[model samples]
Target: MNIKYSLIKKEEDIDILQGKESTFANLHYKYNKETIQFLKTHFYRQDSLYLVATDENNAFVALCSLDSDWWEPHHFFLREIFIMPSYQGQGIGKVLFEKCIDHANQFQAKAIVTETAFENIPMQKLCEKMGFTRWDNPQWKEGITYKLFL
Candidate 1:
């Protein structure tokens, strides 16, 4: 299936927040109301990217976000990455993540950072497969923190 990727602009693509329901490894997932509001208020801004992918049918299928880090000025943060369950295991997520790395590199990011639930094997595998090293971030232990130095 053909897929299109777009870099969302401020004040645009808010409807993506009304994303589809999905599940992975027994975890129920969706762009919930609180997530939508938070994204609109904190993520829809300059110097950040909200990449959304749609299929030939024009239905949203995947998404990944990258933003320059405020805490680590030279690094970029991989806010989130997700592929619709129907679209998983098809390499779309990897391609989308590669695009995000390119986006971060465009800004000369020294590294990229992301985190995932410990039970999320797919995410952890993806991070490791992408050359990310599991970091011992004392500040967070509920999950795994990954760092990819560019």
Candidate 2:
């Protein structure tokens, strides 16, 4: 698989959010034109990283986004990440994850954090495999939260 990473442009991002395979269905709100405009305004400010994995045919096989904020000037909150269903189990997710980790290192973040639904076993397994420790707590949102010190 010859997957290449490219930044998500305005039009492409809108198309993605509206695609049939969108993952945003889990969220309460929908990504519409207004939201797309808002995202464009501050997307780069939050250090948003959107990478599309395209095959040799030049078609997008998968896509992932990493958005983080400097909560403590040295800590990062990894807000989102997702890979398209068609390319789910081909190691593309892992590669994209590594790229995000590498960028996090460059930013000098003391720690990286992410949250996943309790029912999302596959993501939990992947996080564990990538060295993320489950930070279990009674008050934590009813699902597993993983953190890694980079």
Candidate 3:
């Protein structure tokens, strides 16, 4: 498969990135209108970055969204990263994550942070493989936070 990676640019790309059968719909939004609106606001932000991986046919296979931390100016937070079920074991997620790490490094970010539910072993394993350690803090209790220092 000829997979290509690129930063999100057009409105249509956002639509394609938000696939119809996405399991992340609840976290992002179930409706296209709301998703588009949210993307518009965040996609253009100076401190935010969004990347997508597409197949030879230009169909989105994965996506990663990140933004600067609100309280920590030098830290970047990975908001989302998803790979289509068909493409999950093909290393697309790892490629997208590497892109996020590159983005953080390019921006001179001190660290990259992300959060995932305790039951999501796959994500936890990915985080660990990426050299991220669990971030323990009292403020966050709903999920575990992972941090990778640059």
Candidate 4:
């Protein structure tokens, strides 16, 4: 399937990129008013970046959210990465991830970091494949931090 990727530039873009149904229900959050508000607050921040991948029909297939790390100006924290169920195994996630890496590089970020729940084996594997090393004693319980140096 033909796919297009781009940075989310406006609130309307978020509405288009996120649908009512989600493949990541296990993550336990929806694009509701509160979430949308949160996104709106940070979406255009100078230190934040949000990207989306869409199919030919303009439906969202994947998304990635990132922000500058508070403790390290050269580091970026990957806040979210999700791929629709039907798009899994099609390398859409990898493409979205590569976009994040490229964005980091363009901003002169030295590293990218993210955390995933222990039960999310697929995400763990993806991070590993993307060359992210697991950090020890992550502050978030039941999850591990992954870091990829640029």
Candidate 5:
């Protein structure tokens, strides 16, 4: 599949975004308008939100967001990373992840952090595979948080 990358700018991309949200149950929202408004506002900044991959038809297949100012003014946070069901298990997540890592490096970020709830084992495993170690605890009973030096 051809993977196209572009900045999500128009309102129509919201529908494609909502459709892709099914892969991430944490993103389930009762009202899409509110969800759109929230994400559009908080994630529009450059280097924060990015559509890193698209399919042969130019439809988005994988995407992610990085919040650079969360922990401190200089640290970049990998807030949200999602790949469509059709694109999962095809190394799309890794590509998107590496892209975010490059973004962190470019920003001169000291560290990159990401969090996932207790139930998301897939994410936890992926984090471990990506060389991220647990912080604040070992069991991760509260939640899974990962940091990588940038």
Candidate 6:
């Protein structure tokens, strides 16, 4: 299937949170009961990348967003990356992830950081594959923090 990736501007914080699909319902397992780790969010940052992927028929295939870390301007926080379960394991997530990395690079960010539960093996493996190292964050203890120094 052909996928079109694009950048979108947000007028409201909620606009970026749109597009929840039933196709992703099956993904709500133990580690992701009500929503995925990334879905527990508020898209309020103005300095951010709102990237979206749509299939040939203009359906939401995936979403990946990144923003400047509020506490550390030099670090880019990977706000979220959600792919439809049907499209998982096909490298689409990696592409969106690479785009976020590229955006961070363009902004001369020192590193990129993200959080994922230990049970989310796929995300951990993806972070590892993308050169993110496990980081011990004193601020957050609920999830694993991965950091990739640029």
Which residue pairs come into collision in candidate 5?
none
Candidate number with the higher lDDT (1 or 5): 1
Clash total of candidate 1: 0
lDDT of 2 by residue, 16-59 (tens): 65433434335433456665554455457656666667788877
Top lDDT: which candidate number? 1
Give the TM-scores of the predictions, in the order they appear.
0.90, 0.75, 0.84, 0.84, 0.79, 0.80
Q: Residue 30 CA error for candidate 6 (Å)?
A: 12
For all candidates, the clash counts are 0, 0, 0, 0, 0, 0
Which candidate number maximizes TM-score?
Answer: 1
Q: How would you encode candidate 3's per-residue C-alpha lDDT over 1-150 as one tens digit per residue?
A: 799988787646777644344343244323366665675666766868888888899876777788884466699888877787788777777777888899889999999999898677778888999899999846788989999999
For candidate 6, lDDT tens digit of each residue in 1-150? 799998865534224335454232233432233344343343456558878788999876777778885466699989777787788888998898899999889988899999987677888999999999999998989889999999
Number of the candidate with higher lDDT, 2 or 4: 4
Report the alpha-carbon TM-score of model 1 versus the true structure: 0.90
Provide C-alpha RMSD values for all models, in order.
1.7, 3.9, 3.1, 2.4, 3.7, 4.4
Worst 10 residues of 6 by lDDT: 22-31
List where candidate 4 sits over 4 angstroms from the true fold. 17-29
Q: Of the candidates numbered 1 and 3, which has the greater TM-score value? A: 1
On residues 1-150, what C-alpha lDDT tens digit does candidate 1 reach at each position?
Answer: 798988766544745756567676776677876776665664644668788889998888887788774477788888878788889888887887799788888888899989888878888888888899998877789989999998
TM-score of 5: 0.79
Query: Which tens-of-lDDT digit does each residue in 51-142 have in candidate 4?
Result: 88888998778777888844656998888777777888888878878888988899999999888887677888889999999977435567
